[model samples]
Target: MSNCSGESNMSDVLKLAQKFNCFYLSGFRTSECKPFIVQGFQVGLIRPDVIKQLLSFPEVFHFNQDCVELNPAFRDYDTRSVKVDEVLKELKTKNVFMTLKGWRDECYEVKTQFDTPSLLKMDRSATCLFGIRNYGVTINGFVRHPEQGQCLWFQKRSASKQTWPGKWDSMVSGGLSVGHGIFETVYKEAMEEASVPDNLLKNLKSAGCVSFYFESERGLFPNTEFVFDLELPIDFIPVCSDAEVECFEILPITECLRKILSQDYKTTNAPVVLDFLVRHGVVTPENEPDYIKIIELLHVPLQTIYWHRNKIKENGFGANEIQGSQ
Candidate 1:
């Protein structure tokens, strides 16, 4: 009585299992079922009777085809019968919910209730009139010696770049893609901007980060940045991507701090760079007097900067507190 074609092969079933992380529940029903596919695997809703039959299968854990086991903790729930929004809310909080192959429609239905923006429209527009929500990864390359103290590596933004053309900034930084995790973004930006390999990434130490709201003429950008510190050999050559970086410089930590404090850095986003260093205790008040003045000019509250640092430590990453104007 199953609607599924008897012709459905083991390869197809395996693909489904890999995509949804679930075993085949039923293979007979096809006509009345609404099919969904994720990761190239097809899944379909089952009738109550078909659900019972699916449950009867020795390998099947749950009857819901749209719910898949991401981990041992996930239990199958009938997404067809369940309210999508409620399920998505639960999924967001839990972070462990895995969808069956072809369950994107259910996910979309849930996303709609949370006031999610149109990804289609946003993708089309190059100029973000409203601030585009973005989470970025930052890496701070440090060189140190037993006798000589620490130095920091910085990259000069490419002249062709739109925002901060030909200005010195963080060694590496970039926005995370939708659904990309912090570490993934960090690795990606490092590879793209600095040509750092994956093998070297594991050796980098995370020095923490600064969260800030930046409003500019172009649009508002909410940056949740993750900072990493890496101590490399003195002879290490940094390969800069011409598309993203124009050049690289290694400067003494004190000198770097001084430049940032003095506001002599030509980078358009220098304020953000300086704020990050000062907020993270990398540039202490005693070490840099001009930093205080720069902070004063921006009228940025000391408490807010401190809060940004603490929030990153507590949460591992910052979230956008300010919603973008639609």
Candidate 2:
């Protein structure tokens, strides 16, 4: 076994585990010399070979015979290995695991078994679960004018936030608090982020809903977003909330699509809304490469039903009528 200088941090251990793509079993006591498998060798017993392997990998700080005890940070990881045939099957089904880069440096913690349910409420920490996390509702709407065609609206996200800070995004997008419904969340975000009134939002059309699982260099954010559409009068001016929106623009949809496709736009959330719009035929696919890439990555369907569409149709009403009924 490699002799530990008796001084190593959890970060060092995590780097080793990630490099080897190995499982880090935690919650083990140091008292027992449990014989466990380490690098295919039966170690922690009388066997010196296993100890040698463990020592060679300096990242492994604690070990026992039954299992190697790692830092708790890697406890809830998705590190299942697949055979070549299984990999092929996954690729065929479009269920391939895309590698997430840059998480090694981020601060992470193992969700204690007891804290799993409550911790899952937070957007950043929730993705560790096998289930999905409710980040927020994403509203996609249009500001129209008689002469200028439809102008797209986007909001600049707060710079103080952890993910996608200081970037432009959908007009009104935010996380749902613990007790709020999807509609209530969207309504609240629209009013807070754009100064849009609830009465005006009553006319917001339910375009569709999309569930996305994305893990990039930043972090994993699995979102079930409800897309809404609204048509405003040409002269309708949106007052920007400095906290949520840096400024408001009235660019034509064509210009918006161009900037987005070229990656010239600083908005991270715009591509998602644009992808939904393109799938619904609101925006042409020919000029939406960024949106197309997003659809491909998430494997979202070309078109889907708005979560509230059935109820609206059942009541024999449009968006305005449904709002009135509510």
Candidate 3:
């Protein structure tokens, strides 16, 4: 309900953008987390508490003093996924932590980079436990209005949603779950979330991505949002097909920027919106002094941070290389 303490003193959009990226800013202490190594690659970062919890399952998680790795004996992807799922199900049943309670049946592919093969698949809710770098798609739906200049669409999330209930967000946004490519996710989320049809979606234009690291009570989130700009016809009105969205409203660019920086908007959604703003010339270096810094925050180096953490072994793997994933 209230903005960050003394946040009112922050006058520029760059300061507001920094609030969502504390994971790479003032928040993270590399000393407190262990690199979540899997298949000889540094894939995620696990906190000490989570490492301690995983240590209980020695058969599933092999370890050294520096990092915790998925047991090399699993041999292949299916075995690794099933084995890890077994442990997660046990943890969920045991109520190991609060993140397990909101478990969505959805699975997010865990990989060293977006192009790499999955090392394993984990329940979307539990990926944060390993500080996985998750990816999602965000569509910036906007229109060129005669009277209002340029207006962007915003959606009020359903009150029943698991996270960020009843908050204002981008028109069509959904996670990049396993088996879905970036372009495929755009088509799917556009129709499912906003009921925007194929003919309209044909105009979808890729505006690149926004990546950041954010942590909450749920856990660490190193997320990248593949952003797209969909220009809607003036007569087009978006209807929510999937019940994920409560309602949709069109706001002028100024109002959209205000809501994005306000307390009511979903913080995670702000980076993509800010990216849209900066890309469209709404926020500029002449107007916002920290333009370059915001650009850096929007693209955190999540993919490489893991391997570099605490000076991993120069021999290519962490301390020890697991023999399975090729």
Query: lDDT tens string, model 1, 33-71?
Result: 322221222222223332333333324233343432112
Clashing pairs in 3: none
TM-score of each: 0.48, 0.50, 0.91
The lowest-lDDT stretch of 10 consecutive residues in candidate 1 is 105-114
Tell me the tens digit of each residue's lDDT in model 2 across 1-326: 87563324323212222221111112111222233222232211212322443443334324544344332332323321112123223332442222222122221222222123322122223222211233457776677656777677766666664556666677778665555667887877777777787667877877666554433333223344567776665665667565656666667776665545433344335445555556656554464333343354333321121212334435666544543232
lDDT, residue 79, model 1: 31
TM accuracy, model 2: 0.50
The lDDT for every candidate, in the order shown, is 0.45, 0.44, 0.85
Model 2 per-residue lDDT at 124:
26
Instruction: Rank by lDDT, highest first.
Output: 3, 1, 2
* lDDT for predicted candidate 2 compared with the true structure: 0.44
Count backbone clashes in candidate 1: 11
Which is the leading candidate under lDDT?
3
- The CA root-mean-square deviation of candidate 2, after full C-alpha superposition on the true structure, stands at 19.4
Off by over 4 Å in 1: 1-121, 124-128, 261-282, 285-326
